[model samples]
Target chain A: MQAKLDKSDCMFLISDEKLNQFQQMIDELDLFTLVLPFVEESYQRSIWILDIWYSISNEEINRISNPENTMIYPYRNSILGIIKTLPIKRYIQLALYENERLAFLCAIYIYNELDDFISKKMAIKEEVKENFDALKKYSNKSLRPFFDSKYIEYENYPKKLAMLQNTVVNELHEIHKKYEIPLSWTFEKAIDDASKVYEAVFGLINDWGGRVP
Target chain B: MIISNQIEHLKNLYKDLKFLEVIQFGTITLPITLQEKRYDDALICYQYLASAYYENGSYENFHVVMTEYEKLCLTYGKDENKMYFYYLYSLLQVIVRDFDAAVEATKKSIKYAHFLKYHDLIVVNYYNIAAQLVHKKELEKARIGMSLAKFYKNNICESNITIVRGYIGALYYFATMGNNEEFQEVKQVFLKLIKDRQTFYDAKISFAEAILTLNLGQLEESVIFFEYAYLRFKEQQNIMFLINIEEYINNFNLGDKFQYTKELREIIKNSHRKPLDINNVKSVLSDLFEDDTSTLSIKYPNVISKELIVQHVEHALQNNETLYCFHWCFITDEIEELFGKLFVEQLLFTLFETVYHFIFKHNAEVNVLSKNEGEAFIRGISESEFFELLMELEEKLQSKVVHSKMGILEVPIHFGFIHSNQLPEKQASYEQLTAHADASLYYAKSHGQLYIYN
Candidate 1:
C-alpha cells in the first residue's frame, strides 16, 4: 500500500514566490478554449523534461518529500550552469529543440490571454488595445487558425482530453520501460517535467517582450 | 478481460458449492495469471483452488495448493490476503485434528484481522475459537468466545450472521450443567432454525440433532437421525464428518437395525488386515486360558480375529458380567500426512502396546481385534474400573517418554470405551458393544480427550 517515490537527480530551481507569481499569471491567462490545451501540453512537456533529466543526472535525489531541497533546485542549477556557458546560437538551438513539441501549448496560452483581454475591456482601454495589437502582430501564423475556427465548440472536449492524457501516459510508460526506470520514479518525474517546461516558456516570453499577464 | 470475467464466475461457483467446477476453472486461470505476471490475481486463484480442494476432501491437493498459497502470501499478498490465508490454514489444521495448531493459526488470523480492521473476519475467527474451545470442553471459555462473536455480529452493520452455532453451544452448555429446561429451550431454537432454513442438507445440523435426541432418551430417533447425517456426509465426500458420524453411531447400541453393516463391509473390504499366524494365535489363546480361573469355560475359536474376539466378549455380556470394550482407530493416511507418517505410526503402536500391558497387568482379558489397524477389545472390567484405568493410562501416557531412533518424545493417545451392560438389550451381541466403543472413541478423539464412554 505504500508507494515508493522517485529518486531521480533533477530539481526545480524557481523559488516559491516566483512559482506563486507564475501560477497567478496562468490563472489570469485562463480561457476555456486555450487554457485546457495549454494545461494538457504543459503537463506532457513537463513529464518529457523530467524524463530527460532523470536519464542524464548521475546524482540520486529523494523525491518523496521536499522536492525543492532534495531534487528540483539542484537539477535546475546544474542544467542552468551547464547551459549558461554555451554560445548564444547553441542556447537558442537547445531552447527551440525542447520547445518544438510545446509550441501549440504556448501559442494557445498566449492567444487565449490576449483574446480575453481584447474582448472583455480592450475597446474601452486604449493602452490595453495597443498592447494586444502589438502581441497579435508578434504571434506566429501557425497559432492563428485555433482562434478563427471556433475549434472548442466543434470538438468533444472530454474525449479530446482523454485521448491526450492516454497519449501522455503511453509515452511516459515507453520512456520508463526503455530506461528500465522503477515504478517509483513516475510521480516525481511528472512534477519535475511540468515545472521545467513552465520555466522555459516563462523565460521565452520574457525575451520576446511579453510581461506576465 | 475474459480472464477477469472467468475469475468472477469461478467465485460464483465456489459460493454455490460447485467446488469441482471452481477447481477446474482455477486450475486453468492460475497458470495464465502467473504467466502474465499478475501475482495478485494468482493469489486469488490459489485461494479458490485450495478451498475447493478442501471442500472436496482432497487433502493432497489441498496441501499442495496451500504451499503455493503461503509462498504467494509472502510475496504478493497484502495484510488482508494474509489474514484469509491464516483463516484457511486454521481450517486445514482442524480437519487434521491438530486442535492446538489450529488454535494458534486462528490467533494469528485474529491478529491480522484486527490490524486490518476487518470486523467480519474478527467475528469469524472468534467463532472458530469458540468451536475449538467447545471441542476441548472448555465450556466457560467457549461461551465467552461465542459471546464476543455475537457482540461483534450485532455491532456490525446488516450482518448476515447465523446464530445456529451459538444456539448449539448454548444447548451443550445447559446440557452439561444439567439444566434441562434451558437445554430444551436452546435445542428448540436450534432445531427451529435448522428446519426453517432447510439446512438439513448439512450433516453437522443432523449430527447435533442426533446428540440432542440421544440426550432426551430417544435412542431410536437418534440412530435414525445419525444414519441420515452419516449418509449425507458420505454422499458429499466429507470424510471428516463421516468419520465423526461413524463414531457417534458406534457409541450407542442401536441393535442390528442401525449397525451400519453396509458401511462396515465397505471399510473392511478396503482395509488390509494382517492375519495372525498359527503359533501366535495359539500363544494368545494359551495366555487367555491361563489368565482365567473361573468355571465358565471361555471358548476361543481363533486368536487375533475380530469375530473370535467378539464372540468371547459377547459370552461375558450374556452372563451379565460388567465388561468394557476399548476401541481405537489408527490415524489414516490422510492424517498421517498432516502429523507425519512415522510419528502417527509410532504413537499408534506405543498406545496400543501400553494399553495391552496395562489391561493385562490389571487382570483384564484383552484381545487384539485388528493388529495392523491398531484396534483392540478388552473385557472383564467394571465401569468404575474402566474410568480409573483410563485416568491412569492417560497420566502414564502423558508422562511416559517414548524413546525412538530420532529422540525421546511424548505422544498423545485418544481412545473410546463402552460398557456391555449399558446396551439397551440384556443380551447384546459383541458387535453392538464394539460399535458403541468405536463411536465413543470417535467422540474422545474429536473432544481432545483420552477417552469417551457410553
Candidate 2:
C-alpha cells in the first residue's frame, strides 16, 4: 500500500472525489490485507516443500530415473496434479472475490514453486562438469561471476533458451526434440529463469491495482 | 581410589557419550573383571558394555553378553544383585525393542526391590514400567503403574543418581497419558526434585517426548523435541540415530521440515556408518563380554522478559527479520478465588521454573519474565512454522498442572503470538507487534482456545 501511495501516477488521483473513494477502498482492503501475510507464507512453504519432488541435476535425474524409484512416480504425479490444476485457478478466483490485487501474490508464489519442478534431461557442454557441480552447490544468481570469468567455456549447450523461444513460436510437438543434444542453453539460464521469480509474497503490496469495483 | 586403569578408562569413555570407543576399549577389561570374580564390578561393566553394544547396534554380541551376565547373576545372585540384574536386563531389553520382555523384567525387579526394602529402586522400577507401558500404548496399565510410582516417590534417595534420574522423568508420562490428576501430582514432585539438581541431555527422554508429542498430533512440538534429540545425538556422534531423526522428519512430513532438518540431511549426505564389527572386537577379547563389574554410583534457565520480547520485535523489524513473540498468560484469577493468592504464586513459580529450566537446557537466549506472564521469542521463522510450534508449546504448557499442598491446580495457559513481518514501520513498530500479541492473548483468554496467533 505504501508502494502504491508513494509510486502512483497523478492520473490515478485525478480528482478530490476520486481520491476520497480510493481512501475508502483502502480502508476496507486493510481488513483483508491484514490476513494475507499469513496466507502468503503458507503458500510459500507449500511451494518450497515441492523441492524434494523435483529431479533437477543429472545426479538427481539419474537417481529418479533408476528403476527402483519408479514407484515414487504416482506420488510425484499427485503433487503435479495439484500444481497443474488447483492453485493457479483458485488463487485468481480468490483475488477476484477479495477484490484485492495483493491477494494474487498467493498465485505468484505457487507459480514460482511449480516453476522449479520443470525439469527435462539436457546434455550441456561436456567440459563444464566442475561448473555444473558448483552450480548445484550454489544459486545461479550468486554464481553469475563464475560464468562471466575469463577461463569459462559455456558456448552453446543448455537448450532451455531455444526451448523457451520454441515454446513461444512453435506448436507443442514442434517445440521439444526427440533426442538431439544441443549447446544453446546453459543450466545457468534455467536457474536464472526460476530465480527471476521475485520473492513478492513476503513483501507484497497492492501497487499493481485491484479488480474493477 | 583403587580403581583399575582399564575400568577407569572404559568408564570415562562411556561418560563422554563415546559408546563405540567404549566398546573398542572395553574388549580387554571384560575378561579381567571376570578373572577377578569382581561380581559388583563385573555387573557394572556388563551394564556399560551392554549399553555400548546397544548403541553400537551389535545385538548379536549383546545376546552373548547377556548370556554371560545371566550366569554371573545365577552364581552370585542375592537380593541386591538380583534386583540390579533385572533392572539392567530391563534396560537392555528396551535397547533390543522388546517392550513386553522389558515390562516383565521390570516386574521382577520390583519384586526384588520389595523384598530388599529398597524403596527408591521400587519407585524407579514402577516408573520404568509406566514408561515402558506408555511406549506400548497400554495407557490404562500405564496409569496404574504411574500411581504405584507416586506411592513410592517419597523414598527416592537423592544421592542415588539412578533413582533421581528415574523419578525425574516421571513428569512427562502423565502428560503423555493425559491423566490430569496423576499429571498434577507428578508435576509437583518433578518441579521440587529438579530445582536443585542439574540436567543433562537425555536422548532417551527427548525421544519419548518427541514421539509422545507427535502422537498427540503436535507435529511442530515434535520437531522441536526431535531437534533437541538430534543435537543430543550429535554430541554422541551416533550417525545412525541422527539419520533416524532425519527419517522421522521425512516420514511424518513434519513442519516444512526438509530445510528445518538440513543438518541431518547433510549428515546423511556426508557420513556412511558401517555396522559395528563386533566379531572382530570380540576376537580380541576371546569372548564378547566376559564381564566382571562393580556396583555403580552416579553423580550429576533463561526466561524472556516482556520488554526484551518487544525490543527483539523492534530489532527484527530494523534488520528485516521476523521474531515469533509469545505472550503466555496464565488464567489464574479463578484459581486465586478458589484457592488463595499465595497458592497461585507457588503454581506460577513452578510454571516459571519448569519453563526456565527447559530454556536453560536448550540454551535458548532470554531472561526470566515475571511470575504471572511468560514469554518465548522464537526468532526468524515463517508463519507456518510459527503456527506449528505455537500449537506444540501451547499444548505442553496448558497441560501443566501444579500440585500445591492446597490442591492440584491446572493452570490455563493462553498463548498469543505476533511476528514483525506484518508490521508497517521499522522504527516504532515494536509496540504494535507486542500489543497485537497482548490482544491475541486476551482473545485466547476470553475465547478459551489453546492459543491465538496475530
Candidate 3:
C-alpha cells in the first residue's frame, strides 16, 4: 500500500456496475454521509496495511501521486482507524464542533495528510547535499534572503482539490448539527490544522540545517 | 515637486517605513499627506483596498471600496490631485454599475486634469469616461472620449499602450454602427488579448464577444460565451451581473415568425411519448430508440402513460423534455454598444451551457443531429435523395407513432427530411404537413426530439 507511487502504479477505472452502485447509494443515502469506497491491498503485514491505509486517507500525507484517486480514498477507509490517529489532545482541540467531533476529527485526519503532501511538494532544497551543507555554512540571519525569495514566489495548485476540500468541509458542517457537532470546533480545527502544517513545513526546512534548535 | 530616481527611491522607502508593519497588519495609508484635511485620505485608502479586494475575489468589498472612494472624491477638493483620484474613481464606478457617476467623474477629472496641465491624468480620465459612456449606451460620446484619450495615451508611453483596451474601443465603435465585419474584427482582437493573457479583463473580453455574436444573430455562439461569463460572474458572486444576464436571456426573442413556428412544431412533436419515472431522460430515450437500457436509468414507471392521467403525464413530459436556451441573442444590435466585449461573450457562453445541459440531461436517446444532418433536415430532399429513400418505407407503414409499436422496429428513413404531402389534412394544410415533415425528419434522425410510429 505504501509502495513508491509511479505513473503505472495506479489506474482509474470506473466499471458500469460500480458507477451504478454509487448512483444507487447517492439516491438512497444522505449526500452528507455519502462515501465512495476505495481499498489498496498488499500481501500480509496488517500494521503496514493499517498505516498505509490511514496515511492514504490523512490530509497530511505528502506525495499524492494521483489527486483524484487519492481523494476518494479518505472517504473509503475505516472510520475507527482514522479516529485512532487523531490523538485525544488533537480531538480536544477540535472540541469547538463538539457534537460533530467525530466528523471534525475525520476531516482533520484527512487534512493532515493533505497538508503533509502540500508541504513536501513546495519544500524546495537546492540539492540534497547542498541544502544539507547550507546548515553548516549559513547563519540564521544569512538565510533571510533565501527564505524571503521563497515566500515571494507564488505556485499554482490544482483548483479541484481546493474545491473538494471546501465541499467536504461544508458537507461535514451541514451534518454537524444533526450529529451534535459545534461550529466552533470546525473553525478551531481549521486554524490549528493550518498553523500546525505551517510549523511542520518550517521545521522540515530548518532540518536541512542538520541541527535542531 | 518632481524628484530624481534616487530621491524617488528615498520617497518610496520613507513611505514603506511609514506604513510597512501597519500595511502588513492590514492597514492602508495614502502616499500624499493631508495636512489641512482639505482632501480625503478615505479616497486613497478605499482605492488601495479595492485593488486588493479585486485581487482576492471579494467583489462585495470591491464594490464597497469603490463606493467609499466615490463618496470621498465627491466631497473632496477639486485640484490636480483630484484629477488623478477622479480617474481611478471613475474606473471603479464603471465596474460597479454607477455609469452615470462614472461618466460625470471622468468629465470632471478630465476638465481639472487639463487645467492643472496633468497630461497623464487627462488621458486616464478620458479613457475611463469613454468606457463608462459605452456602458451608459452613449455611443457617440464614448467614441469622442476614446479619440481624446488615445491622443494623450499615444504621446506618453509606448510600452504602456493598452492594445486590448483599444480593441474594446473598436468593438463598441463597430457594434454601435452594426458593422458586422468590423465587429468581428475587433472581437477577434479582444479574444486574442484574452488568450494571450494581455489583460486581467478576461470576463469583460468574453462578455464583449458574446454581445457581438449575439448582435450578429449567431445565437449558438453567443450562448456559449455567455455561459462562460455567467460561470465567472457566479465565482465572483456578482448578484447584479447575475440578474442582468438572467433578464437578458429571458427577453431574447429571435423575432422570425417562421422560425418561431417551426421551433414550436418541433417542440410539440418531440413532447409526446416520453418514458415515465426515469430521472435520466437521456437513458430512457436511448432505450426508446435502440431497444436497449442496460446503460439506462434503473428507475422506471409502472405505466408509460394513462389517458385518465393526461395532465400528470403532460406535466412530467414538459418537465423531462423541455430545452430552454436563455437566448442571450435577443438583445438588439443597439444594446450591444452598452456592454464590453468580455461581458457579452460571457453572457453568450452562459446561455449556451444552460441550454446544452438542459437538452443533454433530459433525453439520453436524443441524438444531436450533425450540422450536415440539421441542414439536410431543414431543407427538403427529393425522393431520389438518399435520406428520402431511407425514410420511404417508414412513411409507408406510418407505424412509428403508435405507442405499442414502439419496440424493436428499425424504420428505413433518412432523418434529414420526408416528402409527406399526405400528412392527414386538406391540401391547404400544406404548411402544416411541411412542419410535421420537419418534425418527422427530426424524429427519424432519432435524436431524442423525434419519435416515429413503430
Which number leads on TM-score? Answer: 1
TM-scores for chain A over all candidates: 0.22, 0.21, 0.20
Model 2 over residues B263-315: C-alpha lDDT tens digits?
67777677665543323221111011112111100000133333344466556
lDDT by residue (B23-66, candidate 1, tens digit) is 88999999999999888888889888987787566665776788
| Predicted candidate 3 versus true structure: per-residue lDDT over B154-212, tens digit per residue | 55654222334345545645554456785676567556544633233555556566667
- Relative to the real complex, the DockQ score for model 3 comes to 0.01
lDDT of 2 by residue, A33-99 (tens): 2212221222112222222212121122233222221221222233333333222233333333343
lDDT winner:
1
Q: RMSD (Cα, Å) of candidate 1? A: 35.0
Can you give the lDDT of residue A212 in candidate 3?
A: 25
lDDT scores in order: 0.51, 0.49, 0.38
Model 3 lDDT, residue A104, Cα: 27
lDDT of 3 by residue, A91-137 (tens): 33333222222232234334333333322422343443233232222
